[model samples]
Target chain A: MELLKQSIRQRGIALSEQVLKVDAFLNHQIDPLLMQAIGREFAARFREDGITKIVTIEASGIAPAVMTGLELGVPVIFARKHQSLTLTDNLLVASVYSFTKQVESTIAISTTHLSAHDRVLIIDDFLANGKAAKGLISIIQQAGASIAGLGIVIEKSFQQGRAELEEMGFRIESLARVISLKDGQITFLD
Target chain B: MELLKQSIRQRGIALSEQVLKVDAFLNHQIDPLLMQAIGREFAARFREDGITKIVTIEASGIAPAVMTGLELGVPVIFARKHQSLTLTDNLLVASVYSFTKQVESTIAISTTHLSAHDRVLIIDDFLANGKAAKGLISIIQQAGASIAGLGIVIEKSFQQGRAELEEMGFRIESLARVISLKDGQITFLD
Candidate 1:
């Protein structure tokens, strides 16, 4: 978490009070070593939760989730943002609004992957509005799967995402908690 | 590679002579151990090539590329399928046609990630028509970077993808090569 916070301070660009761009390391461009460390930390935190599978949204979430899945010795399933031609049947879908993109897209997973007997750990790159996390949780619940907890790489503490999920009684573990990105300064929660 | 072939044989679905779905392990639902093995194999093949970075497209390609990046101790960058709010300046863009989706989309990478002095290795999940690979190759060329090779998780040998890239003189390493998917039978090329 310290390393991640340092990376944010050095490489992360504070575009606005609401947006922090980590395209340098965590988003578009990835540091595999950092990802591996994140995976190890998440695994250490939730190792005893009886997690059967790791779930995430496609694109950014896959890296951390896959790394954590490797550490946990489980399979990782990524919810696709859009429906591909190959994926047409037996789907569990949820509508998500991306505050960054300012677009609403449906995230879906095949019902063939998750079931009632499974316990799931949700992971993602950033948690701001919690829309993506909520979407993932909806799909997981539709499959009758139990939620183990939520693992986040970077959480915007100024946002209502964490508060909302915690209100829902989900155990949330965020590695780096950003308290403020005001006046082009990045502040972390103690 | 035999393990990969075995996985394809057991879990891969032959939707048609042109479409083979390995979503059970390779694409949708991913096996981390297999991905680690894949990363190791890619690293072993390109270890002596002086690969400075691992390049891949978003979603499916990220897992294998990250694994390979981890093994080789290099950074991995994935091109975004679409432009987001944060990514609006100094971009390297390429148009890719997805045969599976029957749609054309532009993939872009930030200029900050790639440079003239970098040497890149391209990694992808599947190679059919080679459009994605060609698009990536174009971006790398635009950045004035040298390409070490291409690493593919699965190759449809019957398709023109491998032949076309080979004609362009790119060294390609495909873990599992399928000769045919005719009559719903998944055959591998030796």
Candidate 2:
């Protein structure tokens, strides 16, 4: 977690008062060694929980999900923004809006993948509005699976998504939680 | 490679005479252990190339790319498909027509990541028309980076993509090269 915080301080760009760009090492470009370490940390934290699957929504979350799956020795299932021509699943779909992209996309999982047998852990790169996490949780619920927890790489604590989820009894785990980014300064939740 | 072949034979569905659906393991719901094996095989094939960075396009390509990067001990940079309001990088964007999705999308990469000092290996899930690979190659070329090779998880041998690239003197390393899928039977090039 210290490495993540240090990386945030060293390489994370505070673009606006609200947006933090970690393109150098996290979002666009990935540091595999660091990802392995982070995945190991997650495994250490949630070793007691029987995590049958590590689920995430695609584009950026695949790397960390893969890393965690590798360490945890579980499968990683990434929900798709668009149903591919090949995708033939007909079970559940959730409409989630990305504040950054400002577009509502549907994230769907195959019924063949997740089922009542899974104790899922949802992971992602950024947790801003928590729409993506909510979508994943909904999919797991549709499959009659239990959510072990929600693991996030970077979380914006100023957002209401986490608090709302906590109110619903959803466990949230974040490596680095950003408290405030006012005046080009970052404050951690500690 | 044997493990991958066995997985495909067991879980891969034949959609048509030319389509192979491997979503259960390779694409949609991914098996991390199988991905590690595929990555190790790719590493074994390109281990002598001194790959500086692993390049891949987003949505589905991120899985194999991360695994390949894990094997090579290099950073994986996935091209962004959907442009966001928060993305401020003056990027190198390539317009690619996806025959599968039946839509044209722009894949972009920040110029800072790929440079003349880097040797890039483009990795992707499938190779049908090779437009995605070419888009990635163009991005690398724009950054003045050298192309080590292209790694593909599955390749439809009937497609003109590989021949087109081979005509340009570029080599593609595909794990499973489908020779033909005649009457619901799958055949391999090897």
Report the number of the highest-TM-score candidate. Answer: 1
| lDDT (tens digit, per residue) of candidate 2 on B23-82 | 888678888888888888888889899899999988777778877888899999989989
What tens-digit string does per-residue lDDT give for candidate 1 at A1-190? 8999989999998899999999988888999999999999999999999999999998999999999999999999999986676786699999999988889999999999999999999999999989999999999999999999999999999999999999999999999999999999999998
TM-score of chain A of each: 0.99, 0.97
Per-chain TM-score of chain B, candidate 1?
0.98
Candidate with best DockQ: 1
Model 2 over residues A1-190: C-alpha lDDT tens digits? 9999998888887777788888888888888777888888887877789999999988788888888898899999889887677788675789899888888888888898888999999989988878888998888999999999999999999988799888889998899999888887777899
> Highest lDDT among the candidates is held by which one?
1
Every candidate's chain B TM-score: 0.98, 0.95
List fnat, each candidate: 0.85, 0.78
Steric clash pairs (candidate 2): none
* Candidate 1 structure quality by residue, lDDT tens digits, B22-44: 88997799999999999999999
Q: List the residue pairs that clash in candidate 1.
A: none
Score chain A of model 2 by TM-score against the reference chain A: 0.97
